[model samples]
Each structure stands twice: as C-alpha cells, then as structure tokens.
Target: MQACGLDFGTSNTAAALPDGTVLPIAPDTAEPRLFRSVLFFPEDERTTYAGAPAITRYLEDNAGRFIQSVKSFLHSRSFRATQVHGRTWTIEELVAVLLRRVREAAGAQTGAPPEAVILGRPAVFSPEPEADALAEQRLRKAAELAGFTHIQFLIEPIAAALAYEAQLSREELVLVADFGAGTTDLTLMRLGPSRRGRPDRKADVVGSTGVRIGGDRFDAELMRHKLLPRFGAGTTYRVRGLSDKRLPVPQHVMAKLLSWHEMSFIREKSTQELLQLMLESSDKPETAEALYDLVMENLGYRLFRTIEATKVQLSREEEATLDFEEARISLHERITRAEFESFCQPLLTELEQCTQGLLERCAGAGEIDAVFLTGGSSQIPAVRKLYVDRFGEARVRTADAFTSVAEGLGRACVSLVSPDLINS
Candidate 1:
C-alpha cells in the first residue's frame, strides 16, 4: 500500500512521498514546495483561491475577505462557522478545502491516491485537555473530508527527528526543535543504525514538550512595539461629556489590528463608529486617522506583509527599516538588532524556560548528542543562539527549513508499509 506524509502547519503546508520525494502543492504558478496557509474569498466570484494566488488576489483587489493562519482556529471552541462570499462554512469544512487541494496534488505526483498517511501535529494542541481533544477531532474530520482513508498522528518534533535520524550512521541522542508559526516544539530521542529496524521504537523517545509561541507571536510583538504605535496604539482621546478628562484608545482594538485573523473585525459597523469617535476626539488625530484608514482600506494584510518581511530581514542583518507608504499613512522607522532583541526578550526567555523544563523532565535520560533545528522561525539568529549556547555550536544542526517535517512524516509512512526495510 502506498502512503504519504502531510505536514499541515499554521503558516504553510507540504506533503511528501515514501520515496523521499516531496510533492509541490503550492497553488502558485511557480510551484513552490511550501504552500502558504491562506484563503481568499472574492465578493464577485464564486470560486475561492488558496496559497500565493490568494495573497495576490487579496493585494490586487482588496474587496475580498482574506483569511490566514486558519490552523490557529482549530482549537477555539468559540469559532464555529464564518460567512464567506454569501456562503457559511464550518471550520473543519474550510480546512478540508485546503487539505483536499494538497491531497489532489500528492495523488497526482504518486500516480494513485495514497492508501495511508502520517499526519504531523503539535505536541499539544491546547493547554486544556478538552480543547486539545476537540482540535484533534477536528483535524481528523478535516483529513477524512479531504479523502484520506487511513491516518496516523505523529508529533511534529518527532517527525523532524526521524528526518534527521535517516542520515545518522552512529548512535546519538538528538534534540529536535521545531519552531513553527504557531508553536515551538521540542523532542529528545535516541537514534542510530543499530536501532533503525526495531519494531517497537517508542522507548527511544526520551521527552517531548511544546509552547504555544512562534513566528506569528514575534510578528505581533514587532507590530505592537514598532509599527502600531505610529497608528495610535497608545494615544489618548477626550471624553465626550467629561471636563478635563481623557482616556486611552482601546488597546483591544489595537490588538485586533495586529492580529492576522482578527483584523477584519475592525471593519464592523460598531468598530468603525468607535474608531470615528476616537479620531474626532484624539489628541493625535493624525495617528487615529491612519488607524481608521488602515481598517477602511483593508490594508491589514499588506501592512503585516511588510512587518513580516522586516522580521525576516532582521534574522540575517544587524538592522532593518520599516517603510510603509500607503495613501495618507506614511511611516518610516529603523530598528537595530539590539532593539529587536529587546522587543522579543520576553518570548526569548519563555523559549529558554520551555527548553530547560523539557531537559529537566528527562533529567535521568542519556545526554543529548546533537540539537536539530527546523521550521522557518528557527532561522532567527537569537533562536539559533539559544541552542548553540546550550549545546555548543558543533552539536547544533539544521536541515531544509520548510520540508523537513513533511519528509519526516513521509519516512514514518514508509516504515508502516515495509517495517523491515525501514528498520533495517
């Protein structure tokens, strides 16, 4: 029976074949391997767009509703159904649409639809047990709706370890760090040529842990500290009837503006009325006007793209500049490495604590021989330093940022088909 591995990530998705070939399912005409986890629902067209084309259509014509980071909503019980293009869709149904596209692409690559699949999931979907269970249930339903008859779940970090394990010739204890868009997962496992063929390999897993923080959080931090301030994040407005009294603009509204999934809510009638009142009474009317214009023009995604680009640039350079010139909202700001690091200090500290906690949980286990990092957010210099400082530079390793998990999932599927071949 032929099988495939699917890595359905918060920011991107990919599928891989058992023969070590990864299928390119990105809807972009260029056929990039990593498909953007985004959807665009046009007002005038009945068809929906996904991946890069979705982003392009959203930018070219802002009239449509653009949805991103759909994976994050899987755990929210409050998120039931949303209306799009005069049609209502359940969360699972929306996810199924994206999964179906990936399934079709992978099927085309293999000449026949896969009979089984290994799906990569986070260590914990949510801190709450009920929510986590519900999220997994939703994921399974989505996969089934996408036409996958057989499925198995593997922790993402474990999948990364398996991908790295395939290349190991000697016995080693490895720590896999998968820093994805929605979460950072860690897994410590023992791998070697000697243990490859073992039918029961669960004993090799030493520990696994994850924190609900990743690249999206970093982007939010950058927006909150650097960009949102320019759009009146902290500005104050005078009260309508009170004398010598003023109140700060609602921080919740600013938060919604920075959130990728919540930005569209700012365009609601009630929110717009509040924004208009704030603009009329704000001491810094220009900032309020800019914020108002941003919502009215549906420029949240475009602004976020600029912020995300700056974050990526900072990962490679010591300094970066954010220059957004759209209509009446012109802003220019330069941020140095030290400043960026400071902005993300709290999150960096949380990452360190999470890693340390995982190590403590496996204290009696054997020493880790190497640290493997995967996922796009792992490219950040500060994130790299965290592992290098812990295990030394020589023991740290990295693979292709986006495809490792999918490839690892593929390897896991292969193991199920010919256990002796994968183990041997």
Candidate 2:
C-alpha cells in the first residue's frame, strides 16, 4: 500500500488511500471504515488488543484496563504517563500502540505495509502555543514510533474541504467544519476543480479556527448534569469531628468520576481510604457509598457507555432514557432534547465563539458558498441548528455524505508522496 491519509480521531479512527477511497480497517465492527479508538489490557495477560477485539475482550472478561479517548490527552502538560500492567507508558508510547495497529490494518488491505502517512489533526490542539506545538510534536513522535518513515499532517477541516472540493464542479469559497470527539475545527478556503491538485494550499486557505470542545465534552456534560447527582456530585457530607458542621464532597472526586479514562487511576489506596472516610461522614450515605463502589468496581466506562447511548438516541428522538445497572447502582433518567440542549448550552456557546472568531477573518457568513459538516456530533439537531441558523438550511450540508476527513487526507497525500522523505 502507498502512503495513506489517517484520521486518528478521539472516538474513532479511519484511514484512506491516495485514490480518495477510505480503507475498511475495522472489518470486524459494524462500521468497517471506522475503527473505534480503544485499547484493552487483560489482567495478568501480557497480550494487548486494539479496535473491535479490544472492546470485545474487555467487555467479555471485564478484568483488564480499558482505555479510550486517548487522543484527548495529547496536549496536556500534567498528563505525563500511565501505568499499564506495571510498565509506565508515556502519552506518545500509548498513542503509538494504536497507530501501529492502524498501520497493520492498512497493510492487510493492500498486502503492502505503508511506512508513510499523512495524519489528520485538529486546527488547534491547544490554544497555548507551547502546548499546541508539543501536541503536534508528540503526534509526530507517535507516528515515528509506529514505524512510519515519512509522516506529515493536514488540518482536519482543510482535509474535509479537499474532499468537498473534489466533488464540486464549480469554484466556490466555502467553510468546512470538521467535528471530532475532542475538537471542532473550521476552515475557510478556496475549492473546486480549478484548484484540486495544488501542491501548496496555504495561500488559498483564508483562515482556520478550532475549539477543544466536541462530543467528548458533550458526554461529560451529560454525565455531569444528569448522572453525577446519583454519585453524590452536589450532596453535602457531615464532618467526622464532634462539630455538627457539614461539608460538601470535594469537586475533584466528582471530576474523576466524570473522566472515565482517569477513573481507574483513582483506585489508589489513599483515594479508597478517603472514600471510606467520606462514606462514614456523609449525609446521604447511599450516594457516597455508590460513588465509592463505582471506583472500586471500575464501572466508569460501563456507566459512560450508557451516557453515550443516551446522547445518540437524543440525536434522533425527542427524549432518551439514560439507564445503567451495576451490582449496587441503578441509574434511570429520562431527558428531553430541550433539557439536554440546556445542559450543553455552555458548550454550544463556546462553539459559537469559535466559529465567530473564524468568520471574522472572512467577508461574512453570506460570503461562504457552503458549510460542510463532518463527525458524529454534527448529527445532533441542536448542533446542526447552530450552523443552519447562521448560514441558511440550503447552504449547510454533510461532507461527502459521510465524515470526509480521512478521504480528504487521502486526496492530499496523492501529491508525490515519498516512502521516506529523508532517504528519498
């Protein structure tokens, strides 16, 4: 196989060849073209698994370390490493494990392992310049670790723009919106048959902007507003001292519960002891104990899976039930579109600010010929309304009738790709 375009997304990953055709990397999953971004390490089992088998293995045995949303932590300064079965794995190393899996799958598709890749990335991984640069550097290191001799990057929204432009018959100035699990990127660029194969697209690119908020943040919001109360997010606890003074549970405990990826880390002895103390001094002992049980049993992912299902259902229905049952905890909540939208109002506002910042670099909303939407979160009616309200319903549309970032990256890679830029 030749150098391919790889979209290693937060929630899912996809790769495409130079011919603008996406590779069905995850043939085992329901969506063959899209591989879920998950990794599982079974207890006492040195064997690791990625993609569909990883999820399956983790779900079946429920005894291993299940990791997701790995891409979301790339830019963090505090997140240095994670201990996986006693060996500490850095962020880049963990990412390399997933990238290596993607490379092998691409190799399987064409019988030639690709060592060159053009990776798709958000327009801004971090607003801070140092962090953003570090994020890109870490990604390149991960690609190198995955055995890619030549690796490059394209802004995700621009890649989507290329895919949109490939199908356009006439020239037009358009705004491409590429939403992923961890970020939403927007690009205003010139596109169409007239400029399809340009080697240098920087001049044609008018502006780009992105936010670190996307579907994952929406999931966190759903968990925070709808589910955290059941786990004692807002409840107060009594002091163990003789004084009758009551204290609220520290917000950090709830924050850990909100983050499924870090939930396992909180099971240290110190945390467990703290939970015991909180359980002993709580006004609502049941909720506090439930919180303790959630951590001890490592049920964060299972609970968040229900949260994800609920969000998906609300995208199509007016209401969805967020339901989950563990040995000791039962969550059953019905939420309407209006209520969920209200919960996500703050996130939607941030998105507006993000897009408004991008539009400031252009003439106006009317100057945009089309608005291309990508990613699963774009299907949310409330999110779609944001663009439609600004740029009329007729002007807004999906990119290539699917998430087109990987396809667009593939098109971008068709321009004289090298197996090894350093050697060749």
lDDT of 2 at 130: 94
- Tell me the tens digit of each residue's lDDT in model 2 across 293-336: 88988888888788888998999999988878886788889999
Go through the candidates in order and give the C-alpha RMSD of each one to the true structure.
2.3, 2.3
Tens digits of per-residue lDDT, candidate 1, 1-424, equal 5578889999899888765567877644565688787888888887788778888888888798888888888899999779987689998888888888888777776676665778899997898989988888999988898888787888999888888888999999999999999999999999888876455567889999988988999998898888887889778987767866888888789889767568888788988887888788888888988898888888888888888899999998999999898966887889887788899999999999999999999998877899999999999899999999989999999999888999888877766555433312
Where does model 1 exceed 4 Å of error? 27-31, 197-200, 241-244, 417-424
TM value for model 1: 0.95
Provide the overall lDDT of each model, using Cα atoms, as 2-decimal numbers. 0.85, 0.85
Which 10-residue window of candidate 2 scores lowest in summed lDDT?
415-424
Residue 384 CA displacement from its true place in model 2, Å:
0.7
